[model samples]
Target: MRTIAKLENVSKTYKLADDQQLEVLSQINLDVQEGEFIALLGQSGCGKSTILRIMSGLIKPTSGTAYQYDEKLQGINETISIVFQSFALYPWLTVYENVRIGLIKRQLSSSQEEQEITEAIRLIGLGGHENAYPKELSGGMRQRVGFARALVAKPEILAMDEPFSALDVLTAQNLRAEVIDLWKNKEGTFKSAFMVTHNISEAVSMASKIMILSSHPGRIVHVIENKMPYPRNEKSPAFLALVDEIHGLITTLNLPDTPKEHPISKAIFENAESKAFENIPYVQISRILGFLEVLKDDNGRTKIFELAAKMKEEFGSVISIAKAVEILNFIETPGQDVVLTELGRKFIEAESTNQKLIFRKQLVLMKLFRLIIDKLTTLKTLAEDDLKVEINNRFPYENADKMVDTIVDWGRYGEIFEFNADLKVFTQFEDSV
Candidate 1:
């Protein structure tokens, strides 16, 4: 692949007025190929915008160098167009004048300059509104004016900094589609475009490549190649798989602790049966768990109430305590917290909610099922952290988790006695179940 722009070990350090230096970017190396769409993604203060500014020639890199290739060997190259979140147009200038500003400055003749401005306005879907001023336009329309002005510059690289963040969802999505279409049609001519956004879905939809940066002296951490073809489907299994993979990578970076392992024993659920309840309410169940944690066991077997008080002391309230217990299944309330009744204690001791174990089992079962009955995995082991991760990864997809959850819920209700801990390794005796 031909690299059109390269940032070789670039670092940007800002020396404040008080002489306190802040190192924003450290040892950043990135390459953009000709005609490639790349997205820079990270939390705030990750130096994403700083990189864009450096690329636009508006700021200099504190250390190392950034280079852009000129294919035509043109006379010292030309300007790089930039679009910002602010839309940056002069309020006094009409949309037509704003779009014409860059071209006019290049000493172009009147007719040619007007034609360029007209074409750019038309290209960005603002053709008939050229005479409209920025103050009169909606957020989306004003952004289009900014886009038109940038396009009119005819820059070799188009760099945007959260340009659509201010618009409503539908409008931003529409504009994103338009931008992608513009890029595809102008392949070779447009050369390359770079965007910095915090939205994961935006990066997935628009870019050929997505680079994630780690915060605190921001540095590139992971580069994911989005191989799916456009237009991409946010719901497709392939899309979700990629999203989950990226999520897994990102999550691993933020938390380095080795998770507690709790594998399940098949004997815990040896007599499982499927039953569905349609009228379950999560809030009622959450309250029951909350109250249960506050109640002490009469037999000195450890009351959920004691658990609740401990949770409250550590985590703050009955609700959050109940929720945390819900995550770990230290207490089970299916739409209402019923007494532990022995089985609940059994499930908790088994640590049946470990997510990594569950995910690993799901992977294994998926491969096995595909090779056998074309069935989805049913057996899953999850811990507190895994449950949180699963909820995030499985959101808006398959809802397979509901079934895994049903299995756990059944175990909590004393319908089963098996506990599979740490990825289906064993079947242990449940003293309580």
Candidate 2:
């Protein structure tokens, strides 16, 4: 198979305020080849979408090269078309017009354009709704229009960035099946497909090759060649094994304090220390507590995937909650299983006051929170804006305001500090004062 799109030793970094750089992708290399469906899977904010953008030539890598058909790619790759997660439809345009936009750059005559558009609409099961506006369509139908628009151009590579994520589960399942059917049947329209998704099952079901990425300067850590036949049986042992394997890999990648035997924790912590401050996963306090409570109910041990299913939450969200609690030393992820620590059990079982004390002790142990508390200790009070500035100085890659809010939430919950929303200030908690 011919290599269609390739990123060779690619790295992407964004310059933030005060000359700080946030590296998103590090030394990444991948290829889109003919006769292959590729899936990029990772935690949220792991630069999966950025890889899609780079491959589509929507954005240039800060360093390294992106190649298309063995040539250095510049500007947009005419052979690639993308279906965005948000549907990205023009609300004012009818479905037909939206699909027509795909062929606008091509020098097709009016008749040719109409034929292609009509064929794409029909091919994507949007035949009767061509005249309807976006508002008239359901979430699944809107995504179908997105697919129609992407397919109308007859591009060689169809790139979808979480295209089905916004739809209901049933609708997403149906759409995924339809897309796979299209790939199998629609020969020569698109030679390859690349998708960025967080859904392990989705990737397992559809992708011929799955690349797993690590968070915080995302790197391709694992690539699985899925030999399972098309129309995969999710309930089958082979399929379940692949899912479990990927789950284990992703859980290890996301959780820093995995089993000591694993070398991943060393690299993860080194990366954290080099940055001076670890980027806290912006998870709510209640979610962290609730997650621990669930773990307690599970007799303090369960796989992360099982916990996610039990909580009826997405895997990424569950991972974030787990990371937050893990950072506080409330949980230890041994392989795929999250085992509650002694502190975690005690905190969950203790009265509210004891729980707060335990949480406070954990919060102060973290470098980021310790920095804030030390400043608050010396100053007794700090403005929210100043706190945000300090956080931004330490974590240039994060959203400063959002980080401040998370800090406030966690600190207030632990009784380590108090934020007066009305005054827009963070004051030392009364107990500490």
lDDT of 1 by residue, 1-433 (tens): 6776677788987764223355678889887777789999875556899888776666788887777663322222254678899989899999998888767547888888988888888889997898889999999999998888888888767788998888888999999998888888993136678999876678888899999986445789899888789898889998877765654554344322343211222333233221111111122334443344344342313433334345443211333334433443344443223235343444333443442233223322332112211111233222433443333232211123333444344333332224454553212223321
lDDT of 2 by residue, 259-288 (tens): 322243354445555355667888889999
Q: What TM-score does candidate 2 reach?
A: 0.89
Q: Tell me the number of clashing residue pairs for each predicted model.
A: 30, 0
> For every model shown, what is its TM-score relative to the native structure?
0.58, 0.89
Worst 10 residues of 1 by lDDT: 272-281
Q: After TM-score superposition, what is the CA distance of residue 110 in candidate 1 from its true location, in Å?
A: 0.7
Query: Which ranges of candidate 2 are over 4 A from the true structure?
Result: 256-279, 381-403, 420-426
lDDT (CA) for every model shown? 0.60, 0.87
Model 1 regions more than 4 Å off: 70-79, 187-189, 258-433
